[model samples]
Target chain A: MRPDRPTADEMLEAVEEFLRDKVMPAVTGHLNFHARVAANVIASVRREIGQSPYIEADQRERLMQLLGHDGDWETLNRELCEDIRAGKTDLDDPALLEHLRQVAVENLGVDNPKYSAYARLKE
Target chain B: MAGGSIDAALEAATRKYLSATGIADLKRLSAGASQETWSFDAPTADGLQELILRRAPGGVPESRSTAIGQVREARLIQICHSHGVKAPNVRYVLQPEDGLGVGFVMDRVAGETLAPRVLRDDLYADARTKMAGQSGEAAASIHNVPMGELDFLEEITPLQQWQNTWNAYEKYFLEWSPSPVFDYALRWLKERVPARDRVTLVHGDFRNGNIIWGPEGLRTILDWEIAHFGDPMEDLAWICINSWRFGNIDKPVGGFGRREDMFEGYEKVSGIKVDPERVKFWEIFGSLRWGITCRSMAFTHLTGHDRSVERPAIGRRSSECEADLMILLGRN
Candidate 1:
């Protein structure tokens, strides 16, 4: 990778700007609503591109430690859910609660950083 | 054009039922992905009359799980109106020959259905004070609609509803990504499933958004699409859900009034005691349901079935619901 020009994030920013500035002004009615939604999707993509790797790694570390398991993220999570459902895991385990909270907060960071719930948790 | 391309068919149809000499002021007010709602007028011998046409346009079937069909919806409204529920009177049910897919025309009641306006706008200042109490009063009335009349509605008990929902959500999180919080919530809810205190018609989606109101107060409970038989507290609790509070989080009853007032209103109307514990259980259940719903909306966006911006944006709101659950469960 030659450290490319007009990087993906930059391109995403450009596209978001174009939609908000140029295209959004001309539309009205339902299309206008969809256009705003489209802009939001682009913004979400920008956040995901920026934040997903770290969030995934953070969650994976938490899952590995809490579940006492070392494998892919999805597999470990599957085990956690199955164990909880089958009564094999204790939901009240303090470590488990802390892990779930942190991972959920991290997800909110990516998914909707603006949510008031996220703000309350940050405080 | 007030009278759009469908005017000829509408004109003929309005004449048969409304005794209209002319039909005009027909405009497609909204064309949703699944349905279209039109506002129109029939110039009857009496005078210019405003009525609404709510129809599921042809092609993809406009239906949902066990919801009453549009024809049956009209009948339900008629039944409610006749039973003294404040609902728009159903004027005519569409026939196949009417050229509308399957819908009914009803008298358009005067009120704002938009939530933000009803909550924040100056016009509803008095109505705001009355909403929580009136909401409880209205729910009592809706619950009293005779069981015989609602044979068409689905009967889903709260226990059954929560169990099925938990199983589905469990399977989804297992396959997709797991949340120990959801697991803990599930186990907690299972351990605390309240014995059915009362069974009546539950307005499965009762909330501020479903209400049409004015300065006087609530005119009708709209969107009876998911009406079912269940613990009546399910409806009572649903209105208290934080998401429905629309940022007015302090007020437990639809962002307008307190739980005490809601209970007071309900008890006065139905003479049935309101159980706080049962209501609390349903409130938690409502939060979990909304969290899952937010995920499903995101799933649709991710899967590209409906690429609307709103869906994924709504999906991100799952955290808000989760946070609310934490508060409800007193985990904080």
Candidate 2:
């Protein structure tokens, strides 16, 4: 059990551990190599958060929430994260791609061509 | 490395060049992802001089090399100086083989380049009134850069030759970014790509920040990285882009002068009548282009190449451009 408002570092570390121990090992050999690298990235992100635990925590939380989980996302709360961590998710998936688009637009409240481009990709 | 060691290295470098024609007291300036600017006190044989050293950062965009490099910039400075365009004098360009990496030393022109400071400073209060006249003159002079002399830019198609600048944005976005907004803007832009006008050399990044203003008038025009032979109206539209207005939405053309003034200035020098529709087309394109540029900045942040608050803040400005585009295309 975690606090109602876990720090970004704590969330990041938990996500990293889950990805490494649970997610990475579950992937096929085809994706295992990529998963290992991704795991290292998660570890690096954890190290960065060790320097500043709270900076961009709001943005991080917003990112997690927009990914469809809110509050105390203990370990890779969404299926998309699990798939991404395992390197099993297709980058071309329209739904997942749209989710990424929404996150960018929601975080930065701008309606520029980039957003318009993303919004029209489903068509 | 320790601060003392860096300082010692800087001091040694400064002393090595002290007797040169330009100033040489080097002060470490803030580091940018693409370049590092150093402010230095330069004393020439003639008089005191302020100088700046611009060098590529350890990591820079690969795409940048195709557009403008130090060698090309030096050539542009030479051309501008000969034509009486207010621009910094290029003093020296260190070759790539030189241990300094890609860079040049130039005469540091005085005046505020920052938009907020330009708007707030009392010194420039009256200066704003003269901006229209100065900008007009400067633009005309820039447009008059001898086409025959600029052989390297022969590959750039003139305005009438280009149907859409959107393709450039599309290529950059598809190759570099995962942002979907780029795709959307591409579709919108493609649908509304305007007809071509007469081609002329375009000052690709001509706008407020690029122009230095002094008490007398426009002192220098900087950043010739994107200078290309394209529609002349491209420069006009770029100058009027809302983002360069710097929070001053009412007064376009960098929040200092009217579009008519800029047109009048260019007309006087180029001996060509300004086309209203052509300028309007580029104006819309300018907003679209800048919107894509903002996403590219955001992509840099997202990709973790650089993670500055300024980059993401700039990403937020893309929407302002979208609204502008909507109005331009009559969607709003």
The number of clashing residue pairs in each candidate reads 1, 17
Residue lDDT tens for model 2, B26-123: 66564656566777775546567677767666313234633666567678777778877777887666554445656667878878788777766888
How does the DockQ of candidate 2 come out?
Answer: 0.05
DockQ (0 to 1) for model 1: 0.48
Residues A1-123 of candidate 2: C-alpha lDDT, one tens digit per residue? 344667776777787787688877898753665555455555544544453344235444643644656554333224334444344554445554555444343333323333332233223
The sequence of per-residue lDDT tens digits that candidate 1 reaches over residues B1-332 is: 23366778778889999999977778887765445678888888899879888777641246566566687778878888898987678889889887766888888777988877887999999988889889989999888988887787777776787777776686555566666667667777888888775678777888988888989988888776677788898999999998888777788888788998988888888999998998998898888888887777677668887776787777777777767776665445
- Report the Cα lDDT for residue B247, model 1: 70
Q: What is the lDDT of residue B308 in candidate 2?
A: 56
Give interface RMSD, per candidate.
2.4, 13.0
List model 2's recovered fraction of native interface contacts, to 2 decimals.
0.06
Cα displacement (angstroms), candidate 1, residue B179, comes to 3.8
Segments of candidate 1 deviating more than 4 angstroms: B1-3, B59-63, B167-174, B298-307
